[model samples]
Each structure stands twice: as C-alpha cells, then as structure tokens.
Target: MRTGGGSMTTPVHNSPRTLVLSTKTWERELAAELVRLGHSPAKSRYVANKLLKRIVGRAGWQRQAFLVD
Candidate 1:
C-alpha cells in the first residue's frame, strides 16, 4: 500500500462474498453500519460488500462472531 499525506489507498481484497448494493437506502445503511462497526470510511464499500456476500453467499462455512460480547 502507498501512502501520501497520511491517507492510504486501499487495495481490493479477494473475497468469495462480494456483493454490490444498488439501492441508495441499502448502500447508505450498510455504509453507516460499517462505520459504526469501526471500519474506516475509505474501506466501507469493500467491508460492506464482503458482509453482504457472507449474508447471501452459499451456505457451507462456519459462522464467526463479528463482535465479542
């Protein structure tokens, strides 16, 4: 990753769960949720997409807690 003036460009990660939200409400809501979850704003899309994928992806993987209680 390269950084200039304290901001770094994030590279796209390879994820099996990749979702592209089209509805404005969905996009906005997901971005807000991701931010609330502490992800950087710049990475909101990637994080949100990955999350959507997991939600709608083929069912075969074990579930992990996103937040520890």
Candidate 2:
C-alpha cells in the first residue's frame, strides 16, 4: 500500500496505461475533453498532468501538496 517509487514499482510497464483506460468514467471524460479542446485523446494523460500543474500553481498549492496529493 505504498503511494509511489521504492518497492512499489509496477512490474509491467503497460499497467499504468491499462489502469487509466480501464477507468470508464475517467477515460470517457478525458476523451470528451480532448475532443472539445481539439487535441488527440492519446494525449489525455499528459494534458491532464499539465492542467493539474496549472491548477495547483494558480491555487498556490505547495510543492508537498503537488507531490504528495
């Protein structure tokens, strides 16, 4: 039950993508948003990270908040 790194490394590289695609709600929402913004659905995860960073920056969430949250 670790959050990241250390002994929690994913054994299969495909696991992360599989997990994301398996989340129906998230995958659908991301695809819809990407279409709305004229970007490819393939870029959803990267775009999501960028958007989250922007939100945290604007809201002044500290570095620990960014990393731990």
Candidate 3:
C-alpha cells in the first residue's frame, strides 16, 4: 500500500464539496484528487469499491483468503 504520499491524478472538473462528500477523506490531498478526477467523494468511493472488488476477486487465491483451509 502507498503511504498516502504518492502523487495521483484527477480531472479538473469536480468540485470540493463533491470531493469531500464522495471521497469521505478529511485529508486535503485526497480531496484534491477527488476533484481532479471530476468525481464527488461519493462517486470516488463507489467506483473504487466496485472496481477493487472485481480486481481482488479475479485472483484465484483471493477466494482462499476468504475461506478456511
């Protein structure tokens, strides 16, 4: 995992209220990213969870991680 210090890119179309509401991050940096991506914090959170679960679930070992030996 990144140490919350790496650089990320977001579109320049989103607003601060959106960033805060969607991303739910008190961190100014993260909120900035949410704006850059043109996503409300809520949109960011929703998209992140949706895509992440698919990626994680695609790994064969991921199922094992959710199950007992």
| Clash tally, candidates in order | 0, 0, 7
- lDDT tens per residue, model 1, 1-69: 112322322233544233322333344467778888888999997777676567646564333312111
Leading candidate by TM-score: 1
Report the lDDT tens digits of candidate 3 across residue range 9-40: 22234532221111222234344566678878
Is candidate 2 or 3 superior in TM-score?
A: 3
lDDT digits (tens) for residues 1-69 of candidate 2 = 222333323234454432211223333455567767888767876776566557657987642322221
- Structural similarity to truth (TM-score) of each candidate: 0.41, 0.35, 0.36
Q: Which has the higher TM-score value, candidate number 1 or candidate number 3?
A: 1
For all candidates in order, the CA lDDT equals 0.50, 0.47, 0.40
- lDDT for predicted candidate 2 compared with the true structure: 0.47
Candidate of highest lDDT:
1
The best-first sequence of candidates by lDDT reads 1, 2, 3
Query: What range of 10 consecutive residues in model 2 has the weakest lDDT sum?
Result: 17-26
Better lDDT candidate (1, 2): 1
